[model samples]
Target: MLNRISLRQMEYFVATAKHGSIATASAQIHISSPSISAAIAHIEAELSVQLFVRHPSKGLGLTAIGTLVLQQCEDVLSQSSRLYEIAAESSAAIQGSLRVGSFQSLTAMIAPEVIFGFSRAFDRVELQMVEGDQEVLMNKLRALEIDLAITYDLHQGDDIEFECLATLPPYVLVGEVHPMAQLRTITLEELAPQPLVLLDLPMSRDYFTSLFAKAGLTPNIVARSSSTEVVRSMVANGIGYALFNIRPKSNLSLDGKRTVRVRLAGENRPMLLGLATYKAMKQSRLTRVFMERCRAYISDQYIPGMSSSAFFDRYVSGS
Candidate 1:
């Protein structure tokens, strides 16, 4: 009978265990305290094992059996989530809400595709996007403010998990008239003399600055903007050159200026773009498939910022 306990009971059990009290669990997940107690009572009675050792002075402490039961409850919940995910994927319609966070740079590049693209393909899905720098985005993920994030693998922590989809190799961004744009491949040193249009966001700023630092030089940054589009527009108008990893399908700026993406002729470590989620939380059906959508986007090169023909021409033919 205990083995047949329902998922709701297990949810109450896990929530109670995490919060250390039935009342706390009630507040945590917005269930009544008595309901949580009743679920725990049912599980204990059916199993004929003491799940928690109670004390008047203390709230609740997991007995040896309780500890083991908690682990199993968590496992069950995780598997149950997967079961739902599988079912949702098989049906003609997938219905749920997805809250997404992304690094500011990737948002303009990837958001419309994931939000509107999936909405068109699937039966129904409510989509939301939050854009920020690396720290802001990760903080939201840890606090459970967002379901998942799409960003570079700039930082890794124990509380988070990153599923890498594709790699964005570093390249220099220049205008059509920039001297370096004429070359097949430009070296960082040659561009050092020109003013730099730095993309001044948190981790992103560091990344661009390091590119010059790695080559034993410093950038003469004349313009700085937190916005990726502004940086690109600035460079396209020939204010200064910039560095970037990914190239959009259209090289022309909004103002009808052509932006040049020149491959760097140096040994540089490339940045990886992927999905980030909390390690402990079980992924909902919406998030899992949305992640799949992102992975598919990479494979199909269906993103506006990335050119499909260019990716295939460069990676597929050579490999």
Candidate 2:
């Protein structure tokens, strides 16, 4: 019976052959030199072939048979790499299920497009979206109940990693006829005296409170609500101006007229739309591919003044 050869032996053999030294090959492959030497020795013993001519001063030299074996080893290794890549591509392309958690505001805005893009690219992927506030979403992420999360930069601990995708400056929304609507921007101090309708959510409230503290001012709260739409409706009806991160697509006008969106005068703190994933969680092949697609899609669509075509070409080409 022919002697059986393991993939590891072939890999070590090929690396040693290509580099001309076991030390260099070990460094390249992140393995110890002793291990590489032992693997080659074991393979030689099994095959009963003197593959390498090791000299006292000169490094390893391949014998005639070793040279032929090395050529075949290269072919085998190349095929193995291709097989892995094909399997990964198939896994990425397969339709499966992904459970995602996202904030309420994102569900109506970015989440839909992200889901659509993922579905279009990987038609076999069935998307399940769970909508909640930041706290709820973060809790689910910590518990591993969701595969991925889209939310604000909560500055969660080291266990969770946040990647900011887009940044939108803080703005104030008010009725078109409101006095402040005529101005392009109003200072935090200037708006300090007006009645404010707070979002009442923990994240939003904390962010605004910190902003107010930084500005050395305080807002007089007349009403509070968790619903962004409700806040917009109240602002449109002249209840009060509400500070928000992004300009709303709808409710720009309450009753057929455009409402007002004014950029705050002071340093505009950006609200970041980002992705969050657990640092410790082992990412599956499908998950990694989907994440890559998400990043590519976001960069293509959201990045301004950059040529998406050129960027994609450079990225895919690995240049």
- Tell me the tens digit of each residue's lDDT in model 1 across 176-287: 8988677667778887888999989888888878888888998899999988788889999989988887667678877889977777767887787888999977898678
Q: lDDT by residue for model 2 over 1-319, one digit each (tens)?
A: 5434555567878999888899999899875565567567756777788899988887899999898888987887788667545654785545577877877866666665665656665656777788888888888888888877877886567788888765666777778789988777778888888989888886778887677888777888899999877778788888899888754445454356446777676675777777888877776666666665555434312322222222222322335
TM-score of 1: 0.66
Model 1, position 59, has a per-residue lDDT of 79
Off by over 4 Å in 1: 1-93, 300-304, 309-319
> Which RMSD values do the candidates have, in order?
19.8, 18.3
Question: Ten consecutive residues with minimal summed lDDT in candidate 2?
Answer: 300-309
Q: Global lDDT for candidate 1?
A: 0.76
Give all TM-scores, in the order shown: 0.66, 0.64
Error of 1 at 158 (Å): 2.6
* lDDT score of residue 67 within candidate 2: 89
